[model samples]
Target: MSAETPGPRRSNYSSMPVAYAAIGASSAPDLLRFPPAESTPYEETLQLGSGTERFLTAANLLMTWGAQRVAGVEVVDIDPGEPSEYPGVHFTETGTPELGAAREELFTPEGEAYLLAGTTASFVVGSKDPRRILVVTTVNESNRLGFAWGDRDEVAGYGEQQLTVEIREDSTVWAVARGFTFQSSTGITAGLKQRAHVKEAVAQAQAFLQALAPGAALRNGVAKPADEPDENDQSADDQPSA
Candidate 1:
């Protein structure tokens, strides 16, 4: 037990074996995950409803959808367990749902359930009628909350891809999606296609909140801002009708 004693000098056990798999695994996700095909960053801001209380509630709920796992495209299992306490509770006992299945997936679970980071999936935004799936990755709501896949999964994208919906106190909200980086002209062209779909999805989300706001035109069930002109005609109504 001497500190410097050369007792039992076993060459086999003296040096530890190199583990290539574990060592290289660190950057595996980065190599496989979605690479910036182009640099097409997108950011848009729009005024929702002007109501103080109501607007905040609606926007906040949108954020909560991700946390509670309220939204996502999931098929009902034959054994639809107990009814969820949350109204319109849609969840799957197994399998990770689409990234933005409902409005957004606020909370990312601890397990990857066997998936690649860039594995694309259809995402839906807002609770708009017919939550359609749009272009998106297979990751969860953790993106908006600034979470990454590799955090939970051993091998996942560095988690660079993201979409954020910031709801301010002023009732004006803004959204941003990290577009791809451009390496070449072909990559730029491809990135535009992806950006196009992302833009549409975010817009739908904005519209959903716009309609849900208090000042939205409840008369016709269409969400119209108070400042927005009448649908019949935005023209000068000041002149007397002929």
Candidate 2:
């Protein structure tokens, strides 16, 4: 998505009826074109004073699109930005009509299928780190999905993972958690699936960042310098004993 495309402007649900269709036409095609590939992982360093909110927002947009299209799920945008009664948990409602049924459908088997599909899409969109730092699971009843981001201490330093569980009235659920340490210093070099999504997500994030801060670089994982000084710079006097 181009920065000129606009940022989270009033949700695209109205203009676009089928969310999946829009994603397939816009972002999916690009992702399919440049699939992720594994190579020597290296981090992309951002200039000091860079803001990461743009990247996070981009990621959220992609996740929203994928979730809507793949699982037929809609993320709830709770105003006031306050924590819900569930504490750390947010709520969204979904329903469908039964052919001749009126007042719109709130829960149904079809809705459940849509939720499952959307969850898969959301997972694919959010899953970037090749280390398998994130895992997505499904819950049939209660229409909820669970995501488990594994403990970070296992891979990185003292860090904690994030877990997100989503449920729709139709009994569709999506859950995700931070599983592994993601090093931005090493660009995603895992495999096609990993690289493609990450690259696209990163690119989209970059676009958003550029808009937010023209020259600032948004760092997602770890930051590392690209170029190292030549060994010749080390004087003989400074050389260590062989």
Each model's C-alpha lDDT?
A: 0.28, 0.23
The numbered model that scores best in lDDT is: 1
lDDT (10s digit) by residue, model 2, range 33-138: 3211211111121221212322222122222232222222232321211122111211122211111111111222112111211121112234343222211121
RMSD of each: 18.2, 22.4
Candidate 1 lDDT tens digits, 1-242: 11221211122542211111111111112322423222222333444333333333333333222211222322111111122211111113332122233322322122212222222222333453322111122223311222111111111111122333444556454433332212222354655654554554445435433433333444434333322333344353221111
User: Would you give me the overall lDDT of model 1?
Assistant: 0.28
lDDT of 1 at 62: 33
Among all windows of 10 consecutive residues in model 1, the one with the lowest summed lDDT is 149-158
TM-score for each model? 0.29, 0.20
Best candidate, TM-score-wise? 1
